[model samples]
Every structure is written in structure tokens, then in C-alpha cells.
Target: MSPSNGIQTVALAGVGNIGSPLAFEFLENGLTLSILTRDTSKADLKQYAEKGANLVQVDYSSEAQLTQALRGIDVVVSTLPSGSDDQEKNLAKAAKQAGVKLFVKSEWGLDYDAPNMEPVNPMIASKMQLRVELKEVGPPIFVVSNGLFATLAFSSFLGSLDAATRKAVINGNSAQKFSLTAFEDVARFTRLAITRLPIPPAGSSRVLRVQGFAASFDDLIATAEQVGGNKFEVAHKSYESVADKQLEPSLEGLIAWLLASLSDGRGLLPQDKLTHDEVGFKPSVDIRKTVETVLKA
Candidate 1:
């Protein structure tokens, strides 16, 4: 830890959808910020640099470069896209070599601890592999199991509610509940957790399951209808039926797998309790407001 603030420098890797927002949250919370990206020419780098983030460009495949970039960092947050499991493992190895205090893995959603749960896609399988690798590494780890991102829930990304079509394809029973957390909320909670949570002893870490809201497919459709002032044409599909149809090769297959998993309660976090409350933080985003914002967008 840096002597000045008690908590030393923080570094973020792969500043994409989740990473970018998390970077801003860390910066806003008054932490020394550094960003690692393979490409320096990305336009967002300029914005991050302008906001006082130290931008370090490095080849993800080069362990030497990664070790050098992570040197002297207190915490490392990886928001790398799914399927980059090898890269995440390599980065973890580099972080451990560089003596990083904490490494927050790239698990932003789902309860990977679920028993007998199989990966619905290659990306998910890679994430599971990273978890296994981290357990053998040196740095203290933190995993945030924040169910489905609210942004994806309202968008077509999850294949649940289609905003453009004003249609919802509910899988399994519409009454089955699941969790949803906004990108901003996840970033906020992450900032708090990384900076405030006590560092566990070596070979020990915590998985914090948090969410902004919990709702069923029927609840989501109802929220959409209420927000849009129009009833959406709802269609019910069995989880197996939808999963089989989306098995064709394409990105949609991945989406279908996620949707079906959520519908079947495979990857979703438990909704019976609030992890954020247990940790003394409150999430303010509600399902109705989230739907309205998405509809307005």
C-alpha cells in the first residue's frame, strides 16, 4: 500500500464495457489509477489519460511486459472479455510476481459456485478455468457475483426482452426470479469492496454476491409495458426448446445459452438475500426505473 493513502495504486486491465465504467469509478473515488491495454490508439485511452489515468500499452501475450506494468500496483482489476481465460491466468501470474496485494478476477455476473453447473458457452468455460487457476496463485482474490447486468437485461443482449420488437420471449416459467445489477452499480460496489474490504490471508478470498434488483421474466415484461405504455407481445418457450434452437453456430448461440441458463436458474445468484446490505452498502437502482431508462434510451 502506498504510504500516502494507506491504499496504494490501482490498475485496470481491458477497459471495455465493464472495465471503462469501473476505471471511472476508481478514479472518482480518489485512487491512483493505471490502465493496461494492448492498443494505445483506442480513442477511450485519450479520455482516460485526460482524466489522469496512467496508460500502459502492452502485449497481453508477453509476461515480461505484463509483470513490468503491474509492478508496484496494490490492486489489479481484470475486466477482460470472456474466453480470454489464458490471458487472465497469465495476468494473475504476472500480478503475483509483481507482488500485487489484491486481484479482482473478471467474474462480473453469475454464481460460478453453483453445483453441477456446466458452462453454456466457451467464454463461461474459460472463466471457470481462471477461477481454478487463481486458487493456486499467491495474490488475494475477490470475485463479484453480480447476476445479469441491468443494461443487458433491458437490451437485446440477453435475448430476454427485445426493446425494438416490443416482444419478450420468456424461457421456462415467467415467475422464476433472478438478479440484475446495473453496470454503474456494479462499478460502484466494486470500488467500495476493493478499497474497503480487508485483505484476506494468502490463499483465501471472498466472493460477494450483490444485485440491484431481482425479477422474473414476467416482472421484466410488466416493467417494460409500464415504462413504454404499451403491452408487449409475450411468448413463452421452454428452456430446452430455446436452447436447442440457438445451438446453431453464431454469437446468438452464446446469447441463447445465457438466456436459457438464466431462465433455468443455472447461473443466477440467490435472490432470497442481499449481499450488499450484509456488507453495509445500499444499491439504489430499481427495476422499474431501470426499465424506464432503457426505454428512454
Candidate 2:
């Protein structure tokens, strides 16, 4: 099918944080959707079915069931968790066998193609491996790079700001900018790409780069303080300290590496222009408003 043909039927595998919103976006765009879930008994999963989505309960390990569920899907969006590489590979193979036209991978973060990129995060390393494997045998893939999810940046994941303690950690240069996208914006842009992105002629795929906002850590801290109506006690962690911590073998090391990467601007979009220009859609989320909402929540 050509890009001009447009997407009609879409299937989503793994509807959690990102997938749930993407499924809603697909339905909001008036596209036919099939949501594949392992647990149909969950209230959230049932809610989608109640709202007219075709819910297919299947085992991720069952290739036959996966292929059968994806038989008529024009596009397959996998929003599986970071460590679910094997499940993603399985879905890719099923999509190829089921003749799905497009396969959107679960990459909603930093530009994997950035220069001198290293697998500091094990999840990113797994994603890189999946990309290579899909290129060789999977269906046509669309890689969406939406920088860091704004929600995660302010959460405990990056260690930049602690909502609980009302504390902040500044890594390296406080003025270095980092790209961020609200989770809602990610869903909206993804829906546009799946339904409207032009199909490559052949032997090619699409890489989308998008960001909701870009600001320095200092700026983010200020935003947090303004939104939360409280002053945070700030501390500094040098890049060398974080980088050295990253060299250790543990989850803490992984998080340290991630902080160092974001501090040094290694895992962000290379440019300021949003990929929405290519899709002809404008993102509407404001970073300040989003931070305020998150803080209030």
C-alpha cells in the first residue's frame, strides 16, 4: 500500500503508559483499531473494548496467535516496556508474516542515530539490536524519536528533581539544554505518523524527530519551583562523578549514565526544528503548563 493510500486498520501491542494513549489517539482520529492485550480481564483493557475497540487477547510467546491477530492490520505499534526486546522481536516477525504495511517500534526517546552514540543504557542497547534485526527481516519500520518524555524528566527517574523531598540535582553545566515532549504530545504525533506519513517507495523507512520543549536544567528547576509553589534545596553532581558512577555495574549505574548523557546533551535531538513540520501537524502542549499539572497531581 502507498502512503497516499492512508492507514485504515491499526493494531496496538502492549497498551500501557504510551500504548494506552496511542490507542486513544488512533480511535480519536477515526481509524479502526485492534488492541492486543494479554489480560483482557483488566478494567482498563475492558474499557477499550467497551468503547468499540476490537480487543484481541493473545500470548506474546505465541507466534501463530500474534500473526493471526495482526492479519488485517495496516500498521502495528508496539509500546512494550524498555526491557521487552524479545517481545518486540516476536511482534516484528509476526507483523512481517501477517503482511502488515508498517511497524512502529517502541522508541520514544533520544535520537538513536546521534553521532558517537554508545549503549550507556542497556534498554537503548537492546533497542539498537532490535533496529538492526528489523532492518534485515521485519516489515517496514517507523522509528519515532521524541526526545525525553517530560513526565519522566521531572520524576525520580533522572534524579534531577525530587518531588518528594523538594530537592534538585544539577549535573554538569546547568545551562545545557535538553529536549522534552509531553506524553500526550507523543501520542498525538504518533497517531499522525501512523495514519498519514507517506510510505517509502521501497528499501527505506522513516525516522521522526519531535520535541515539546527544550530548556536547561536550571530552567526546569525554576519551572518546578514556580509550579509547586515551593523552593527546592539544590545540589550539584559533576559530570565526572555521574560518569564514574555509570562505570559501576548496577541499576544505579544505568541511571547515572542516563543523567550524564542528558547533562552532556548526548541523547537529545540534534536540532531545534520539530518533526511535526514533516507531518503537517503542530503539537499543542506547553511545557510550563504540563509541569504545573504534573506538580499539582
Best model number under TM-score: 2
State residue 4's C-alpha deviation in candidate 2, in Å.
4.6
lDDT of 2 by residue, 1-297 (tens): 223457889999878778888888777778889998887777878767876799888888887889999998898888887777778888888888998888888887888778745646665676777887876666888888887888787787676877667888887877888788887789988887776777653334677888888877787778888877888899987788887786555678777777877888875687744678777667677678767767877
- Worst 10-residue lDDT window for candidate 1 reads 1-10
lDDT of 1 at 262: 73
TM-score computed on alpha carbons, candidate 1? 0.90
Q: lDDT for every model? A: 0.79, 0.79
Q: Tens digits of per-residue lDDT for model 1 on 49-104?
A: 88889999888888778999999999999998876877888888899999999889
Please report the TM-score between candidate 2 and the true structure.
0.92
How far in Å is the alpha carbon of 145 misplaced in model 1?
0.6
Model 2, global lDDT: 0.79
What ranges in model 1 sit over 4 Å off? 1-5, 116-122, 243-253, 271-274
